[model samples]
Target: MTKLAEMQCEACQVGAPQVSDEELANLIKMIPDWAVVVRDGVMQLERVFKFKNFKLAMAFTNALADLAETDFHHPGILTEWGKVTVTWWSHSVKGLHQNDFIMAAKTDELLISGK
Candidate 1:
């Protein structure tokens, strides 16, 4: 299997299946900073990226949006003065998908690449 960051997201349409518990556990290991959480009783993944100022925070958010567009999977992003909290889940399936973890890895790549 491709590394999560090296993979592209597959669409999570209404009938799509969420990732298996085994799969999610393995993938989450690749992005340890991310937390598996329940929101509205649906499982999701979240992580907060910190920055020195609002400008850098917004820059990260924009880069993340661009990445999401490429993958056709967007996350819920909260841009604050010095941090951006990103939440990823499959809205249609209402749970976690491989795409969510893949995008989470890509999000970390954004910070590492400093783009």
Candidate 2:
């Protein structure tokens, strides 16, 4: 199994993969501060990485790009002066998939390490 597949909730294991939209909504609602969102056919988790200037932001963007490429699960990244919006959705599925949440968790891990 892939890394994402290996990441299973102990109690929720042995069931169907991925989550329904209603399940997703309830789960997301519980995590009121995650900034993880689903809308307009996208599953996104946005984080504002603060930096002193635009150069630092660009550098972080490049680093994030490298990480995305290594994972083979890319996100829609919008880099501005001090923030980069990362939206992760499985294009093949035409909706949110398990990979999207896995990637979001991985991205959050990355931000923690960068700090």
lDDT digits (tens) for residues 22-110 of candidate 1 = 99879889999999999789999999999999999999999999988888888999999999999999999989888888899999999
- lDDT score, candidate 1: 0.90
Q: Estimate every model's Cα lDDT from 0 to 1.
A: 0.90, 0.62
Residue ranges of candidate 2 with Cα displaced over 4 Å:
1-18, 22-48
Best by TM-score: 1
TM-score per prediction, in order, is 0.95, 0.65
Clashing pairs in 1: none
Clashes of each: 0, 0
Error of 2 at 38 (Å): 5.2
Lowest summed lDDT over 10 consecutive residues: which window, candidate 1?
Answer: 6-15
- Candidate achieving the largest lDDT: 1
Output the lDDT of residue 58, model 2. Answer: 82
